[model samples]
Target chain A: MAASTIMKKTGAALVAPVGWLAALIDPPLRALQKATGLNGMAAFFLAPNMAIFGIFVLFPLVINFAYSMTGGSALFLSGRTYVGAEQYERLLTCENYLDKRSCVEDLFWNAAGNTALFVLFQVALMTVVAMITALILNRELRARGFWRAVFFFPVLLSPVVVGLIWRWILQRQGLLNYLLHQFGIDQVLWLTDRFWAFAAAIMVSVWAHMGFYALILLAGLQAIPKDLYEAAEMDGTRPARVFWRITLPLLMPNLIVVIVLALIRAVQIFDEVYVLTGGGPGTSTMFLTQYIYEIGFAQLIRNPGLAAAASILMGAVLVVLTLLQLAASRRNQNAGAAK
Target chain B: MGRITLDHIAKAYGSVEVLNDINLKIDDGELVVFVGPSGCGKSTLLRLIAGLDQPTAGDIRIDGAIVNRVPAADRGLAMVFQSYALYPHMTVRRNMAFGLENSHMPRKEIEARITEAARMLEIEAYLDRRPGQLSGGQRQRVAIGRAIVRNPTAFLLDEPLSNLDAELRVTMRAELASLHARLKTTMIYVTHDQVEAMTLADRIVVLRGGRIEQVDTPLNLFNKPENLFVAGFIGAPNMNFFPGQVEETLPDGLSVSFLDGQKTPVKAATNSGAAMGAVTLGVRPQHLHLAQDGEPQIPVQVRLVEALGAETVVHATASGGERVLAVLPGQPAIAKGDRIALSYRRDLLHAFDGDGMRLAGN
Candidate 1:
């Protein structure tokens, strides 16, 4: 009892300075609150974050839009001429829209076609694979934690590291071909063939980031109550029917999130694929972001104007896709409520 | 055809056992309730019968066939979960029609059953609404309707009314009893509340620590509990137990003595083997009253008195430091800290041995 009393005294002594410090600042804070009502105080506290966002994000976005409308290869605004929509017109000019070779900006058209195909295949594959992985991991298995860690470990690896590791494994004299040679098979130019290289890019991208998407899907799957499944079981629902009717409908929201995020990320594919293929096999694997980088910085006599216009066009597509998805999700919600 | 039987049912997770040697039988159209405190394996036993779980060892027969290896769906038993478990995304109509659809019933038949069930439960107005849009009671009705549409041989309800508010629970309890009477399907219900068990059950199985204490009609379990646990668990405010010793075995009954050396002849049906030994005398509060002139009495100091308008319940301490409660009829003048003498008829007292088993009596 005496020791507890002494401890209590010590605790009070330790808290004394914090109380004094609060007293010192309390009046000024009260005055500030009085000067600015609640909403104004909220804005006051948000000012620093807003300033940082304005400088880093909004400012660059505005400059990029300005660059898209201008002419010349100058990096600074003062040196460029306002040529107003010429870049966009140049991008849109095409003899036969289906054939990239017929477009004036054939490289841009080629990259756009490649990105469209990549996003279609990559997003579908990523969502399906992640959902399957999440379902398997959610089951009651031995060393479940260890298996989950093994699946999620790749998500922690740097994209560059992922690219390098796959490159080593898929190169001509790499582990895959070496092992094939040990079985008396001829070596294949895995990264040089156009179809194989494109396939490799999609496969590697899925492998590199699927764990994160799977983790999101796993959280969704877990949020579904266990008793619902039991109820379905008692209802004598066939396994496939239950998946199609119950699991799929309940999992729709998370599936939409995964698809949209994967779609956006697939369009912005640069670093890993760039490291792996260098947009090679004669530009077969080139995508929109890589095309922008090449025009903005990589090529001799770089054209920042064209690159900025292409990026803004890509951003427009993304915004439209996001709005469409948001509307779709909203319709689903309203339908659910009405039902 | 829902007569069900469990022979030597036992369940354990790894080595830690939850139930042991549970045997029970239910008639074709009777409503049996499993009532016990939590962790007494009531829910586990229900799940075993439902085929949601495989027992560690047992033979479960539905009708006359051993269904130990049958799947839950094949067992033809529909369960109403405590959570109500209606698919949140499905409308009430679809929720009820899901099982019928799975059975490949014709579309017209499915709609007919759903309409009938919705009309029966008075949930027709909400059939187009999803579970999320309905109130708690409505959701519960939808859950029951889902079970009813299946036309299963037996209905397994696991604490189905436990999630409702008190007033709603009482109302729903009456509805369930009436529904059972109308349908006449064998039903096995699980709950920890003895009142629900007593009100709804054709027979109540009282359990403790996963072992069956007594299985009898509601009033029988109340009037003649086989063990001390059942007696204490089955009633409101609990039966009051006072320590005593058996003085002698009379031809009529056993003579028991309290700490004050006052002899009370209890008219119980016991053999001559009820010789001199320690005993616990249990008397329900309702059986006790203020002592009349020149009768055997227990002197107590009233610690508290709850004078509910219908009855007066006095909580007091006996002279021997044992807590005693007496429920007297109607409003009577009583106050806290008042000295009072209570009395009871000898036949109303229950005696138990040291092992917590009720001494043989009617």
Candidate 2:
């Protein structure tokens, strides 16, 4: 009884300051609520977050669009020439859309081609590998947590660090070739050769990002009820049939999410690949992101307008993909509700 | 042809044993219910028989062959899970057809089976709707239909009616019994509800802490529960237990003295020459009646009275502070603090020895 009395005293002591603060603030808050309404109060509470979002996201987006319509090597919009659609025209102009060599901005076309191919291969490869990894990890294996951590370890590393680490291992005189040499194999140019460099870029990007995607898929896999699987097992379903009918359909929502997110990230792939390949071996690995960086900031004479135009185009594609993801998820939600 | 024999089945996860030394033979077409409280390994035992889980030790024989190595699909058994476990993504028809389709059954045959099962379940109108759209009872029917369409050698239901409301559960229970009569297929059901077990099972297996306590017809189990646990578990209001000691061994019965100093004659026999110093007397609430002037009496002070129009349940505290329940026919003039003597027939008294094993007698 004495201990409980002491506890009550301590509780009151702790609550006193909070009570004072609430009393001090309650009058103004109530007055504000009376002056405005619940919606206004909600907006008041949301003001800080909205301010940060507007400054960081919306403001820069408007600036980027403004820059896209102008052409110059100028750092400020005031010094730049307002040549509406000129930057877009230069990027779009080509003798033949297919042949990059016949285009006015051949490097831009080449980069676009490389990026398209990269997005196709990298997204497909990443999703499949991630799915396979998630399935394996979801099984009852020894040290399962350890294996999951190992798979997700790459996601914690900076993209630059991932790029540098892989470059050291995949370079001509690197660990991979050195190991191969010990096995009586000759050295091969991993980053210097055009095909090998492109392949290496794809491999490293998948290696770096697959873990994050796999974790998402793993969560999706776990959400499926164990009893459903048991019921299926009792029904005498083959493992393959079970996977196709039960696992796939249930996992479609997460799968759609992973695919679209991977697609967006793949299109924006530059940091790690740039650090690893440097768009080397006669621009064979140059993607649209690297091309934008080279024109906007890296070159001796910057073309911010052209770079902004390219980025806006990429943003358009991402928006379309985002819309697709939303539609797919909405359909899934409807189907789930119907079920 | 689905006479399942479980010979010395034992299951364990690492050092923790869930079920041990279980042996039973379920005759073909018999509907046996395994009844026990939760964590009794009843569900685990059912899973082992379904081939969803492999027993750590022993042979599970289906028909005449040992099928310990057979996969669940190959074992030819269907199970209705507690959650209904209906595929939420598929329409009711597709969910029912999934198993047959997996077996590579022809389209026409699969359709026919699904149609028949749907018709029998009275879910033909809801066949095109998914499980999420169906009511709990409808989903339950679909789950049963899914199992029925498989037409397996036997059916295993793991508390299939548990998710339904009380009224629906009663309705479904009758439906299931009727369905079993129509099918005459071997079924192994597991439930913790004694009423369901008593109403449904041809023979009920009473399990306790991973061991079979008793396996007998429901009425037999109720009439003669091999031990204290079965006696207490099988009754609704729970059989009232009174601490008692055997005072004298008579030629026809034994005279026992209760903690309240009430002496009663129990019509029970012991093993020849076995000592029975301390024992317990059990009497079902329904068997107890208001005592007459010259009858064996247990005087108790009424604490709570539950009047149910047709019957009244008197909750009273005996002299030794034991809570006694007496379900008297019609409303008795019983109320809190009323001191009344409860009595029972000598033959209706159940006596168990010190070890809780019932003394043998009718």
Chain A fold similarity by TM-score, each prediction: 0.90, 0.93
Best-matching candidate per lDDT: 2
In the range A1-339, model 1's lDDT, one tens digit per residue, is 699999999999999999999999889878988999888889988999999999999999999999999989888889999989999989989989988888989999999999999999999899999999999998998998998888899889988999899899999889999999999999888799999999999999999989999998898899788898999999899989888898888888878878887887888899899889999899999999999999998899988999999999999998887886787678767755764
Off by over 4 Å in 2: A1-28, B270-275, B360-362
lDDT of candidate 2 over B15-49, digit per residue (tens): 98999999999999999999999999999999999
Best by DockQ: 2
- Per-residue alpha-carbon lDDT of candidate 2 for residues A1-339, written as tens digits (9 for 90 to 100): 699999999999999999999999999999999998999899999999999999999999999999999998998999999999998899999988778899889999999899999999999999999999999999999999999999999999999999999999999889999999999999989999999999999999999989999999999999999999988887777888889999999999999999999988998899999999999888999999999999999999999999999999889988999998899889878866676
Task: Report lDDT (Cα) of residue B137, candidate 2.
Answer: 93
What lDDT does candidate 1 reach at residue B327?
89
Cα interface RMSD of each candidate: 2.2, 1.4
Query: What CAPRI class is candidate 2?
Result: medium
- Report residue A8 deviation for candidate 1 (angstroms): 7.8
TM-score of every candidate relative to the true structure = 0.94, 0.96
